[model samples]
Target: MTEFVLVPGLFTGQAVWRDTAGKLAAEGARVQVVDVGPVRDLEAHIARVVAAIDTIAEGQDIVLVGHDYGVYPAVGAADRRAHRVARIVYLDTGPVQDGAVALAAVPDQELRERLAEDGDMKGELPVPSREEWSRWGSTAGVSGEALDRLTAHASPQPLGTLLRPLRLTGAGDGLPTTGVLCAESGATIDTVRMLLRFGDPTMKALVRPDVTFFELPTGHWPMLSCPDELADVLLRAAAGEGTRLEAVGEEEAGEEEAGESGYLRPFLLDVPEIPRERRGAIDLYVPEGGHVSEGTESGEPRPAIVFVHGGPVPEDARPTPRDWPTLIGYARLAASRGAIGVTLDHRLHAVTAYPTAAEDVAAAVAEVRADPRVDADRIALWFFSGGGPLTAPWLAEAPPWLRCLAASYPIMAPLPNWGVNDSRFRPADVVAHGGTPPFVLIRVGREAPAVATTVAEFVGAAEAGGAPVEVIDVPGAPHAFEGLDHSDAARDAVGEAMGRVLGRLGLE
Candidate 1:
């Protein structure tokens, strides 16, 4: 019989893996949940996993499973016992490289400081509170009784485990490996590969050319939220089935075909005016089944909204169907809520300045309008962050076909710091334009004070000019709060904003 060894992530013992182990055993595989007792350092944890593998009956096939912080030791043990391990599976995490620390520090500076202050007391990092869990942890799809159990078993994690770096000698390079990613985290296996291809240190050591990748649509804690599904994935990984290696370029196409919801489609928009190297593409999100007409006596095609993603930086501006999870989530939400969603990529600041991005947006709108499935006469424009400036022309001389314009934490005026010239990129200059369209602006009140000040000034100007504009304020939320923190406030803010836009378009 094949034996599977399981290692829990930070802040818990073997209890975290109990559900998964039970399910795996029910499926006829022998399972062992290793206890990483008193994780003093990397070496100590690895020893525990290695010891578990040793106890397995001789000549039996062995599969090793690791989750989050546990991935470091699991990979270490796989390296030390390569000849004995058959396959290694990683859940919601990747391997830590030889020279790199497991985690340098928490991503949020505020959270890191709090953890440091709290660590001084008990020498361990406390689990986040219920509010914090709602923003981050509660994504696992567990609720009611399951949630109660999760809260009861949660424990503090050791600081030593997080501080130490893993040491590897390439011993596990050829070991058969598989990675299961949490979709809510905005990461997919292909996205991980793309990050690794670009030389991301944290991902470089985890993914290899031969590694098979699968994605789970749940939150970080799959064991607690969806153990049966997690167990099934583990079975497939152990059997060496369910996924196959494909070239990076081909993965996106495959995802579209196998997309969770059948509403996603990709299109390449040509920008002959710009160099081919800088031309960008767009992704269309429509109702599942197919794009069908609505809102007319004869049921004419559905209205479309061109989505412009934020970013003046080259890295942030470039578009891929998989990257920008929040944008994709917004697009998916729009499609599900009865609007044809169009998201496009534009040239970055590195390629050219202001007008280039504007031109790309125009081209994308034209392409989307030309589609037979879209009602060109009822089009709208939604801009995010830096993409807001491109709305100047539309605001100054609104096209008769344009119904409305919406912005999220938009930069209404040119900032000298961003090298934006006041004369060309200013939205205030067009506030007096006679043909300005109705507008909706969503702002996070707790964002940079300068942003709030600029938006307030623009709202005042638009009101004075008699241009209809609606402002939705989400207090105590920071910029990009929807993606940074998946709090209920964030979801409601996005839904409310989209609802207002849809109503203006006569689609609601």
Candidate 2:
């Protein structure tokens, strides 16, 4: 028989697992819940879990299950007893990198600082009010009675637990792991895969063969809200029955063995290179016969489309987002269709750099408009990926000169974990208020759930407010479909979207 060791997060302890434990035991599986009573530090918590593991019958299949903050000690114990443990389960949590403190993962800087200050003074952090629970994670599905019980039984979490750096050895390397994501908490299997595509080294371990994922449609505390469902997921996870994520290159290599890299995939329509000019951080591709008459104003000022590439791109990333083939293709394509193509290198090198990056974009727009060969009154802004949120300010109050707004596989709202508290970047919220320029959104069917959810919300809000929105959806494509999907549908969608933006700029 397989034995399961359950661990609880901060505040509520063993009692929080009562329902889930009973369900697991009723199914004839051995269950043990760790109770590190009044523990002041993470080491003490780990010791308690380790003691429980030691009590299990020798050679009995042991699966360690961790919930929320409980994941730390559970993982620590797993590291100490990797050989004896059959598998490890993480509930609504991702792996904490070695030397990372639990408090560091809190997305809200103000809340994090407050918690730290209180923990330092009081020795423990107090439980938040019922209304404040939403800040931690969605409290949906949690019954009123359960909420009361949670509050009644809640205890202050030790400051040390949050501050202590998680120490890991290589003992648990390659240990079979299962992650149970809570969708209401704002992370899903597809979203994690999407983030991994950006090549974040910390999350690379998630795509390994021994790792798998399961998602529950409840809030952060699934044990309190959906104990039965949580139990079933736990059983399936212990049996190694969950979805495995493909690495960044795995799907492409399997689909197109000899083709160019996904990012380097050919553009949907073929267009000859236009005349190119480099000025500062901007690149301008002018259509044939379109030229600036030096020392004299040109007869006709062509409209221009400034393309803003997406990122949290590494500062050291070679060639930058402006030089990416996809951005270049879109720029050249714009020039082919009678509009000047504009691309620029923005400073969105990190998630926290949105403010500065937005400035770079505004400056780029100013520079593009000042060019004598470009129509100052007729200009369009097209953003991709992380650059999507930059559209929020314009959408909130569209300038008369801003002819159109376009986004391809854009993230309209910041992810819950990104810790972005700035309201300026939330396009969905701004669109809800109504007055906005025409929006051309290129949506993909296979987009990450988090990104897709934001787009859906933005469209819904726009429709509710009677704002104009034109959706060009590619049902079989992924997030970066321009380069990843080479089918007719992908090609047609790209061309149509570009034409729509160009048409808005009086370039039909």
Overall local distance difference test of candidate 1: 0.67
Tell me the lDDT of candidate 2: 0.80
**Which lDDT tens digits does candidate 1 get at residues 1-508?**
7799998776657776788889999999999988877667668888999999999988888999888777888888988998899988887775555655544323333444455455432266677654455433324476666666655776776676666667888787778888887765434553454454334455545545556778887767788888999999999888876453344333455432322211122211111111111124877876553322264423456777777865454443223432455566666666665567787777644312568888888898998888776788888899876666777878876888899899987867543113234355567667754448888898877544334545777888887787788888888565555544455776677778888888777767
Task: Name the 10 consecutive residues with the lowest summed lDDT in model 2.
Answer: 255-264
lDDT of 1 at 375: 81
Name the regions of candidate 2 deviating beyond 4 angstroms: 10-12, 114-123, 139-153, 183-186, 215-219, 224-229, 240-264, 274-281, 289-300, 314-319, 345-350, 370-372, 445-447, 475-477, 484-489
For each of the candidates, give the backbone clash count. 0, 0
Candidate number achieving the greatest TM-score relative to the actual structure? 2
